[model samples]
Target: MRRAMTDQLSGRLVEGGHRLDVRVYFEDTDFSGVVYHARYLHFLERGRTDFLRLHGIGHRALMDGAFGEPMAFAVRRMEIEFLRPARIDDVLQVETRTALLGGARVVLDQRILRDGEVLVEAAVKVAVISPDGRPRRMPPAVAERLGAPAS
Candidate 1:
């Protein structure tokens, strides 16, 4: 029987960050046959989500009040740099690292690279908020987990 693949199969923890492989499909490309600019955001977001998941935090669990309250991370700001274009069928690696952890926010450094060449880079700030949309301090457990590298 084939072994059941787990979340770790989708991505793996690296020395200083998390790495997820993303393939550029036709849907992700523009009329010019290159990856759409905004699609990089989706790739980066997936890396961030998986990074958190590998650290024992999940979107569903957080939304279900697993951390003592229903909360979610909302992107507060993002600065993106488009360095080069990626063609369809190209395999890209999305890297995510927690650059800073604060009471109510976490800053992430993310990059999309192809064959070790950076195609896109971004700095993202995400704020933890309650279900009602009010900013809230990150739970100690969540904060601690995010601050440490995944084992």
Candidate 2:
């Protein structure tokens, strides 16, 4: 069912990425009702998380060492741009795609859009780490799965 079940709650894996629809609630906005800039990070994070989940590389399994050694993913860097503001009640789509994959990190490009108009864009770098927070090489199976197509 590749890219065919966007109506699912967790969103769906698209042809080249993942798509999630998020509602702009009052709590996601500020005093003026515009979405808070920081909140966009959460939306983007969820997109990435779900993307990995759909790719069969869930964080819970990785942290539980289902890949053979316990590890976690952490944001190493993020470059974001706010193109426009979203107000309450708006339904925004967050799109996420893998831009790069390395031995110990993955770079993702994300965007938030309303009615097909891009409102925000971001480039995020995520690193694999051990339970002690030390940097570590991404497990081979994990990297392979990330580079491979979704089932």
Candidate 3:
């Protein structure tokens, strides 16, 4: 039997956090054969997205007016620390956990690891916004599903 699309793309929730596995391809590497700094951001983003999906929240639905208006998440700020370098053909795991959730903002702590060794760490703050870009609070049902307090 074919697996569901979400099953194939979503990560598992572990210990109140999410874990997504990512493989580094040639294109994700720089001239020195190490993962490009910016590519780590892509991996981290995927982990966060999948984390939300696993909780029954999807970006498409948000943008499709699921909550009275088309909405999206915008990264308000991010602090990243590059600890070790990842090489081509390496499989990395991205771990993400919600650190804080507010009416219109969510903060997440993310880490990239290879074989249990930390490679990168990041703290991300994202704001929920309407399509027009104004800040908006997340729906109560959505927040509750995500284990966050609804404002």
Candidate 4:
């Protein structure tokens, strides 16, 4: 059973390009002892952080860099589907992949899974913005890292 479980997850991880492991805590649970719906968004955020890190773009560095432009990313929209319940103490893996990229926005496909079962899936759209809060074209370096063509 354990071997089958590992194989299933491994296959999914490969399909997603990368995987981030996160263990749900008490704070993430609700009155029913299952992970609160909002907490799934937090899990997805963590996954995005790890995904950027893997591509060598840390949030801190982006916020404080030679660009000195004080860049920030805003979630313009998100479509989420909760298929299963996750409980406290459950170790979930978040898979993130870039599905689409536009001049000023990116579409990310993220999923939370446990033991081969998908618990949640989300389509997150984020826009790159300047410190003044105006949407801007993604920096070439960041775009290239994300597999987006450099402008």
Top model number, TM-score: 1
Of candidate 2, the 10-residue stretch with the lowest lDDT total is 1-10
Which whole-number lDDT from 0 to 100 does residue 23 have in model 4?
88
Model 2 steric clash pairs: none
Better of 1 and 2 by TM-score: 1
lDDT string, candidate 3, 1-151, tens digits: 3457666667689987899999999999999899999999999999999998887778998899876678898999999999999999999999998888888888889999999999999999999999999999988776676674332
Per-residue lDDT for 38-83 in model 4, tens only?
Answer: 9999999988876876676777887785344668778999999999
For model 4, the stretches where C-alpha displacement exceeds 4 angstroms are 1-16, 66-69, 148-151
Q: Rank the candidates by lDDT, best first.
A: 1, 2, 3, 4
| TM-scores for every predicted model | 0.93, 0.91, 0.92, 0.83
> Regarding lDDT, does 1 or 3 come out ahead?
1
Instruction: List clashing residue pairs in candidate 4.
Output: none
Candidates' RMSD to native: 2.8, 4.0, 2.1, 6.7
**Model 1 off-target regions past 4 Å?**
1-4, 148-151
Model 1 accuracy (lDDT, Cα): 0.90
Q: Which stretches of candidate 3 lie over 4 Å from their true place?
A: 1-5, 148-151
Which 10 consecutive residues of model 4 have the lowest summed lDDT? 7-16
> How well is each residue in 1-151 modelled by candidate 2, as lDDT tens digits?
6444533767888878889999999999999999999999999988988888888888889989999899999999999999999999999999998888887888888999999999999999999999999999988888877773332
